[model samples]
Target: MELLYEEAGQPCFGLPSALATAYGGDLGFTTPCLYANFVTSIDGVVALGPEYPSSGSAISGREPADRFVMGLLRACADAVLIGAGTLRATPGHLWTPDHVCPQAAPDFAELRKKLGRAAQPQLVVVTASGDVPTEHPAVQSGATMATTANGARHLEGRLPAACTVFVAGERPVLRMTDVLAALHAHGHTTVLTEGGPHLIGSLISESLLDELFLTTSPVLAGRTDTARPGLIEGFELLPNRQAWTDLISARRRGSYLFLRYRLRSSCGLGLGLSAACRKRCPT
Candidate 1:
């Protein structure tokens, strides 16, 4: 499918061939997944205000441009996993291009068909404390919750019978590495992580991110402390270990900047350097 974005007042479309090249990695890479890293303006703001209707207003929900980029991101993901805090704060339709089976009981037949299987491209929630309310819309949509074994049991009574909860670890906080590994084990390789800053920071700190898609908005939220929080606090990457995110695509749709980046592999460091030197040396 053709993915479109807006850049510098012009429409830019992402070519499938380009996407493949941009995302290419080691053929033996066991769990190739995609992680999303986005930042709002300087203010620590993702939404406008309490209403959380995108930009905190009804007249315009999220800037149309942002919505489009997000939709494209969702379209490309095999599964969308988010933290429980994110789900509780911004619960809405999980993904797009997928039909919403509002009714149709016994099984989410329509939703399942849209997802393409009994368990393909699942919507997953990651939680440490298992604090999610069972009545949440995300849970109601049959989204599976991934937590530790203790947390899962603690939440068993509240969770719906249809929901499948997976234990990611034995600890209290859900380890993202374990979650990703489990998802990979289940054949859900192309995972997407949409975050709430803290969660994003945690992933980055843990070196679990594979790629980043950021949509920069034109309007700046003035509250630097409350509205615009940096992606991470005290975030530092060691030399040579700095994340190598290459800008693969850029688009401008209206007042937003859509950018995509592919994370360079850290595994080939010494080997790549040695090979380069060998190529340059005299026979």
Candidate 2:
């Protein structure tokens, strides 16, 4: 891995020596920050439609650098969050550092130890309909499910003993703010979410996300009749709206481009919330 450029004043967690070397540079996040990680095709397609499962791996072709970066991000987070849809899409996946890049497992463990973090970052799954794959290995291994009251009722007695369930909101909607507040209250301030596009929409709709780590795979995923979602789904943020971001850093490994961006200060206000955005983004 090679770091092409990085902005000043970035947070530094003082990662383990081995991990830092492999990652091309140090990485860290501000306290209480909510960041996202995703790999997308050259054409900005993050998902190859719901019919094609494990779209991320396919997009990146399971590149070693991409996997290492994924593991590094997971290792740095206090908890790994995802929506039920993401879990369903990747049946056997585990949201852990070692699971993606076992070659760097020892370094990841060392990093966690130095930071006084848990053996593994806690896994958090969000759902509104309560329709989760309880048998998925990631869920079966252990996870914290945040869902609606109706969802909780539906999941009652179905989740494994290792899993913990929480009712985050009422039926029909589960606010990302409430979910994040709960996680923060539980001492998980440095959170990393790898949810699918739908979940990304929810977080961005509320202007909760702060940073994005994007990997541009050197392949084009042309869209056809099927629904192929980009990095942000469920809404449009162009022309009438804007999602301008500032480039924070850039790195590269082979043909893949690892880029980091800081979301604009608009707070992601939709047309309905434009008035509120004024107070959030005075400029």
Candidate 3:
């Protein structure tokens, strides 16, 4: 079925349903994976400035398609994960709140019944310093904080009762892989990584992302050196082994284009197999 969003005498379809279909199996299960969502303009502008504006003239030039994709993606995620820095910079109701949309929110109650306990997918904050403002709405609503050893130590006495701070790394910044693994361990498998660019780049560099959902607006900021840089520096993927991604779907909404790409298997030999071959066929 095609879903559409309307604005300014224009009707735009929701993100391609095919993108959602690609993640049909084992999304919120024990898969250590994440999907990245990005909104950019046709001219390749993600935002007008360094700091995103909350509303009004700031977003006037942006297309309605971008806004629709953002809301839909959040609604579909098991849990929304953001860097502490992004939370601090722009903190509010991240995912429309569970109480606001009983039907739209993931069936935590059903999950609880199956698991024999209330299993709400946690809102995770990745922080190096554990310095998130205690009064932030997310903190108040019991968002979990994941940090490095030093970060937990720094906020040892400051975190709220509901927040779970995991010291998964010794350094100040927790590795992206470690953080995702911990989330998977906690049963939050369908993760969404909304960004501040640096975090997105880090995840891409680590090869931890399984899919990318992008909304392209029709406007162009035209400035390359804005306050907030583009989500990606360029179009090229990081070089290592052969990286493969397949375009799942695309839809036009208002003045934006929503696209999704799924990461496929990479081409490479495993270390264990290579070692066994060398031992058996050594000259």
* Per-model TM-score on C-alpha atoms: 0.68, 0.92, 0.68
Give the clashing pairs for model 3. Answer: 40-217, 41-217, 42-217, 50-227, 50-228
Q: What's the CA error at residue 158 for candidate 2, in Å?
A: 0.4
TM-score of 1: 0.68
By lDDT, the candidates rank as 2, 3, 1
- Most accurate candidate by TM-score: 2
Question: What range of 10 consecutive residues in model 2 has the weakest lDDT sum?
Answer: 274-283
Question: Model 3, range 100-160, lDDT digits (tens) per residue?
Answer: 3343334434433343333444678888887888777778768888887878888787877
lDDT of each: 0.55, 0.85, 0.56
Candidate 2 residues 1-283, lDDT tens each? 8899887767778888888888887887766678899999999899887788888999999999999999999998999999888988887899999999999999999999988889999999998877998899988898999988988889999999999988875546888888988888788888899978989988887888888999999999898799888888886777887777899899999899999998885334311123222222111
State model 1's lDDT. Answer: 0.55
Off by over 4 Å in 2: 170-172, 266-283
What C-alpha lDDT does candidate 3 achieve relative to the native structure? 0.56
Better of 1 and 3 by lDDT: 3
